[model samples]
Target: MRPPAQNPPTPQTPDPATAAGAPEPRTSPDTPDAHEPPDGEEAQVIVVGAGPAGASTAVHLARAGVDVLLLEKSRFPRDKVCGDGLTPRGVHQLLRMGVDIDGPGWMRSRGMRWVCAGRQVTIDWPDLGRYPDFGLTRSRHDFDDILARHAEASGARLRLGVKATGPVTDRAGRITGVTATGPDGRPVTYRAPLVVAAEGASARTAIAMGLERDPRRALATAARRYYRSPELSKDEYLELWADLRCARTGRDLPGYGWIFPLGDGRVNVGLGALPHRDHGTIDLRATLDQWLARLPRHWGLNEQNADSPLRSAALPMGFNRHPQYSRGLLLVGDSAGMISPWSGEGIAQAMEAAEVAAEAVVLALTRPDGPRRDQALQRYPAEIRRRWGRYYRLGNTAGDLVFSRFGYRPILNGQVMSRPGLLASLARLLTHLMEDPPRDTADHVLNTLVKAVPLRGR
Candidate 1:
């Protein structure tokens, strides 16, 4: 689906009477096709999905003077179900991309306000040499469009209203490109020397290449809706509530809830939970309804104030996929299951991985089709593991062991919440904000601690 226009109408408080209805369908005006593939139909690289990961990869490659083709099923400014919250880590990626954060529609935030068992604590983002000490919240409708446009401006040929069906392989079974359906609903083939799959959780391209999610990893589901709440609209901190309890047992669930202000007379309300193998089944929609019903009446979380229909999506976390690079395909973002198991944040990790992937692809393209190219391509996974392998290993273990037992309450109720220094350290760890080369005490300790742990093995 396409969005209303290039200039998105800012998300505003919805009228209570009209709030519960379905959203209007928006279509792309330029549906004929923006850029048609050449007679050869070959590019230096092909990136699937126009989300943060793919767009970022295309942007980096295009800026480096590579002929990149970016394909997206949906058009620009389309709706994407998300919390719309950005941490300092994500903010760093935006800045690195040279996005104009100083412009309008940017909802600046100070930090995170966590609530558990009626006790509340607000932790400001730490001031570090590597990252900014602030965060922001923006609707995904406009966020992804901005990134895609940024990539297009950098010289990536973006094909909208196109869906890639499967891989195009040669005799040896190495991916040469992808077979897709064009906007006219006709078959189209686009060739490339290499393919980058950033196709979110489904990982269709990667799956067609014989890659699948590891069954042992933890998965989370989150449901979110918007509400008109003037009081919370301009709150400087992203609010998180960790006290959601199951309906029957009244026991705390193994997840967290959030209330992110949109700064436009509306707020995003949602809850995310990790499913336990032994827990059988959890109805995410029911759970989200139960938790929102418990919110303070003045906050206006009821159906009367609902600005959008409730939406939910699965979260693949803690590197749920293996062998990030196989054959001639490179996996980035949700396709590789790079979402953090700790904070449930994926944008930052996706963009970061895109940078690494772009660098690897650039190096590989410089070399001929030989051992040198393969070595360069192999460095992508190694650098990723060096950066996040150990940390995600610890997080996955915690999800399987700690969160299942007491949720996040034990840590929230402990002295760590009372101690600002420890809380800051925990925040940094959860968001993966620790800098390399040891910038400060927290970074030094966190880096050393992560390195001290053994990397997870296949």
Candidate 2:
């Protein structure tokens, strides 16, 4: 099982909350044009919402000598609901971004420990030449702040406390800039030849730009809180419990719970549930209580030990929002719904998507503003599809055919847990870590399975 997005107070935080925006109703004629805005600020690239996607995009672009503007609605060190665990995939991106992971407040993790049906198995993160061997955990509060600062240090112009309200489009209905609310409560517009919506899941700007979440995709809810668990605070493995059940109905639910150590006198404990058929209406809070009640008593997780309020948020998974690049605006991170449906992992996906978006945006900006530029921009989504589309398609298919009905129960059974090698292989597949060239039986099987799964709407 994938690590749940973590507690609010741990040093390792999950991805920040989805950006704030409502579903678009309709475009207003009063919208600002791309070329004409009173007192408009300008940049070659304007990125809205400086979380992982926005900040990572800025870091990559600015390092490439492109002018970039990164805007954020909140100040540094603010809290965001997240699971604080970072798999090796995420660690790879943080290294690419030049984040100093060896520094303080970064707790390293070796692998995952799965608990289900009175059976438990621990698997270490696979060692590969392409990625790090270990994972990390840092609360979203500090995690986002670090990325924003890294972007700024890399030469991205950061404007904090600025919330982008909508995209500024030309008469052709092509986005050319963003209109945002300034820190001083003034309306402002920032123009650019290209714009990136790196904001999280709200997807308001995407909707305003005529994109919408595909109803066919999956959406899940994650709730987390930090508890002062001295015994588990420095544990090396992220623990996932697949034995979740509905407290009232006494029926096993198709979901998982997690306890990730923060190494700072606390552990980020959380649970996430995909959309289920029969148990869709389970009370998450009550379910959490029930799950916690069953853990080892020595861990000392109790109401008084809770360090932060238990908060829940939505994770838009499996590319629910599509057409990642449209009308001069490129959707990055949660804005494009890049979270993995299988593991509920978004940090690695978001940062990685930021890298992909940066590559496309850099190339698109090099070409003249015309069909060629549009074509270059279009490669953003196409390349993303080429890289992870098949895996995600397989995940969504499994979600529809299996998880929606059984949740993690089937996978967490005694048979699957009895074989450690199989469990390790499953982890590799779930996290998209299998070798690309099919070096082993597991790799070949996973690759074939992915290839056989039809792409959605194919």
lDDT of 1: 0.81
TM-score against native, each model: 0.89, 0.92
Top TM-score model:
2
Worst 10 residues of 1 by lDDT: 1-10
Candidate 1: where is the Cα deviation over 4 Å?
1-40, 456-458
| Clashes per candidate, residues 3 or more apart or on different chains | 0, 17
Q: Which pairs in model 1 have colliding backbones?
A: none
Backbone clash total for model 2 is 17
The worst-scoring run of ten residues by lDDT in candidate 2 lies at 7-16
For residues 1-458, what per-residue lDDT tens digits would candidate 2 score against the true structure?
A: 11112111112111111122323323443343464335456788889988888999999999988888898889997898899889999999999988999999999999999988789899999887788889999999899999999999999889998888877665445666777888887888777767898779787778777678888775788899999998899999999988777779777665688999999989999988786654557677888998889878889888989999999988888888877876677899899989898888998999999999999988877776677787788788889998898898888877776666667878768988999999988889878887778767888888888888765551
lDDT against the true structure, each candidate: 0.81, 0.82
lDDT of 1 by residue, 167-283 (tens): 765533456677788877777877776899999988998887767788998788888999999999999999988777866666777888899999989999988888687775667
| Over 4 Å off, model 2 | 1-25, 28-37, 456-458
